[model samples]
Target: MQKREALEFDILFVGAGPANLASAIHLQRLLKRHNATAANPLEPSIAVIEKGRYAGAHLLSGALLDPRALDEFFPDYRAKGCPVEATVSKESIWFLQSKRKFAVPFIPEPFSNKNSLIVSLSRLGAWMAEQAENEGVQLFDNTAASAPFMENGKLTGIITDDKGIGKDGNSKTNFEPGLLLKAKAIVIGEGSDGSLTRQLSMHFPSISAAQRYETGVKETWEIPEERITAGEVHHTFGFPLESDVYGGGWLYAFSPTLVSVGCISSVGHDSPVCDPHLNLQRFKLHPLIANILKSGKMVESGARTITSGGLDAMPPLCGPGYLLTGESAGMVNMQRHKGIHLAMKSGTIAAETLFEALLHNDFSTGRLKSSEERFRNSWAWEELHAARNYRKAFDKGLYSGLVQAGLQLGIPGLSLKTTQLTLPGFTETPSFNPKKKKIALPVIPEFRADGMRTFSKERSLFSSGVMHEENQPCHLVIKREDIAEICLKKCKKEFANPCQHFCPAGVYEITTEPVPALKLNPSNCLHCKTCEIADPYGIITWTTPEGGGGPGYKLS
Candidate 1:
């Protein structure tokens, strides 16, 4: 590859989500504070890179905002326009069966959210971007940081993905190589399952400890005015998932007629039939949920993978010239199903540490290591430490997890006694063997999209506004030609090509017209990365797509 265009900054933050946005805002203030006395044009420069076509196009979350970090970030933020759609006023928990539901008499203390507000995280990211720009941070949308640029066994900066290419591995008419963005200090806040984050963590042996993941699918509905009580919050467990599977479902009435229904299926499932997409379809047909969604019109839907492991298994925060924050560093509090606040807090700490390093003319691990210690002392750290064993406790079964979690709630010290389950999600299931296992399902896993209430995968993908250039090379790579043959054999025998069942968007299919093979529809990709994590044969690798190609998620 020939040399490409390059840009330099004093500090560069990747991803335009909450964490990087918060860091850029804080760093702007620090830079301005330092240059208050003398007007130096050579002072620190801050920039943020985002893959979205716009500020909010690639962000998603169930998204109830805890105002702790926001309160600290901007005390007078209320004066500015806020994106909170509804303040959570009513909350409840329930256990549901196929035909009935029963509310838990008492809601757990940790699950309480009296002051939180329901929000579209994408909207929040746009608002934060506005705040960052006001503080003089440069924002670059339609640009994606693909991989870390390493030199001399240390980090230097990042390389953006190439702009144009074709399926034949040759440049197109609009061919353009990736650009190099250099910075003295870098911060990666690119949500869970990010491409660059994966490279940084996986390639580096000392930094790659966190590996647990969960697939989350969500849909927005426009119901009748009388159907929903605004600001209502509800969470569920037990019915949709088996006793051995670690997962749950959620519903929240964020507006007068808009409700979000979703399901989360953890990756360390014991059944070969642990299909998350089909599981959510079954969950919606349940009487309890079906009643709420009756006569409702589907608005939008999307899916994303979550990083569930916290402090105990998280990747290292600092290496040489860069610091990792947000879900990329495993900052989520799995017990509460919350992470935006913790991610923002990590950004604040990263900002403080980087500013100090820049001021002192040092970017080595020796100086950047302080950021990790600073995070360890923050409230976000305290919360994660207390709930560190929450997700891992479920490895044995739901009962063991529930018991351990219940005990830790009343007595925080019990967390020390909680055992850590370090099982990697990819190694949990077995490959297809017709004689040994039987596939279980609610509906045929191969249901076609109807574009109506019972929408098919392709129609559901349309709801997400997903797009990719037809001429671009396939992003989902299969290691060998025989792998498709194996999947085809399993499809014929028993498994029915599990990728079609697992992908929230219909990206994979088995074809027999020309020849029996596993076909890929990359244009329908939701960018969820579930196929990369859950493939039984361990052959798929999802590389970065074109610079500006993906679902344009506005309200996810």
Candidate 2:
């Protein structure tokens, strides 16, 4: 590799997600206040780099925004033109059987959303980016951070993704190497299971226990205006998932005619077929959900992973000259099924600590450590602490997990007690024995898309607007050289080629026409990273391809 051109900045934030955007905006405000009273004014260059074609191009969420962080970030967020679909006015919880449903008599306090606002997360990211830019922060979309740049055993900056490389591993006519971005202070706010975060963890100390994740598949629907009222929120458990699986379904109306529906499946299941996309399709077949969307049109669809490990699984927040915020730091409160507010709050706290470092002209690990201290003292820490054991509670089974959750709510301090189940998701998956005559596949209900009320994965993916350059190198890398042997001999007999079933975008296919082999269609990738987390062998590595290559999630 040749030495690339370099760009220098006082501060650089990676991944233009809510956390980094909030950090940039808040830092500018702090600088403005300090300049007003200081003898010497400080003007430092700050920039944010995003991998998507635009700030919100790859963003997806079933978002219900708590006003706590918004109130502090912008006192009058509504007046300042923050994008909100609707204010939550009604809520309910339901337990569904194959064809019927039963509503819970009382909603749990943690599940309540009476006053929260429904939103399109992608749109919200766009709005936040505009605000940050207005504060004089530079925004660079279509630039993926390949890895953290290290110097003398310390974090320095990032290396952007290279371009114009052929699939054959040769430089193209327009080949251009990645740039070296050096910064005094760097903040990483990449969402769940980011590649850069994984690279950093290898060099730095992380939680002793493996982090947990849940794959969520979502779709936006245009239904009859009279079927459901705006601001209606509904959550359901049972029906689609098995007794041993921990997951559920959610439905929220952005308007009388537009609704967001999705399903989340825990990756910690003991079966190889924990497919979230298939689970969501099964959820729509229930009478309650089916009747509401019988005449609906599918508008958009996408998938993403949630960092559900909570406070205990969080890595150290700061290293030398670098800081981690948002989902990258595991700032979510899974009990409430909310994180956007917490992520934004973490960014604001990081801004405060970085602002102080700027004033003193010091960017050392000791100075960056204050950001972690401030986060611990903030309300975000308190909320996460209360829900620390929420996700792990479900490791036993749905009914048993529910009992544990109920007990936690009823008894003070009971939630803090950790369970003995500490195995990571992949290790829990059981293997099938080919020698056994009774070897059976995991049970997943059969579904056929009507192209109206229910949809196939291909139809849903079309709505996501996903694309990538076909001539570029495949981003899905199989770490082992014996992928074919594993997929054909061992995986075929023991696990039944799970990648073909787990990938939401149909990126992996097992073809038997010419010969029994593993095939990949990397261009169909939604950038969800599901294959990396759920693969039993942990052989798949999802890397960034060319810049601006991914789903264009607009109304998600």
The candidate that achieves the highest lDDT relative to the unseen native structure: 2
Q: Per-residue lDDT of 489-548 in model 1, one digit per residue for the tens?
A: 644455456677778888888878887777899988888888877666656778888866
Q: Native-vs-model 2 lDDT?
A: 0.85
Candidate 2 stretches greater than 4 Å from native:
207-209, 412-420, 424-441
Model 2: per-residue lDDT, tens digit, 24-130?
99999999998999999989999999999999998899988898887897787788799999999899999999988899999878778878999999999999999
lDDT of every predicted structure (CA atoms) = 0.79, 0.85
**Model 1 / residue 546 / CA error / Å:** 0.7
For all predictions, the C-alpha RMSD in Å is: 3.0, 2.4
Runs off by more than 4 Å, candidate 1: 37-42, 268-272, 413-419, 424-452, 482-486, 489-496
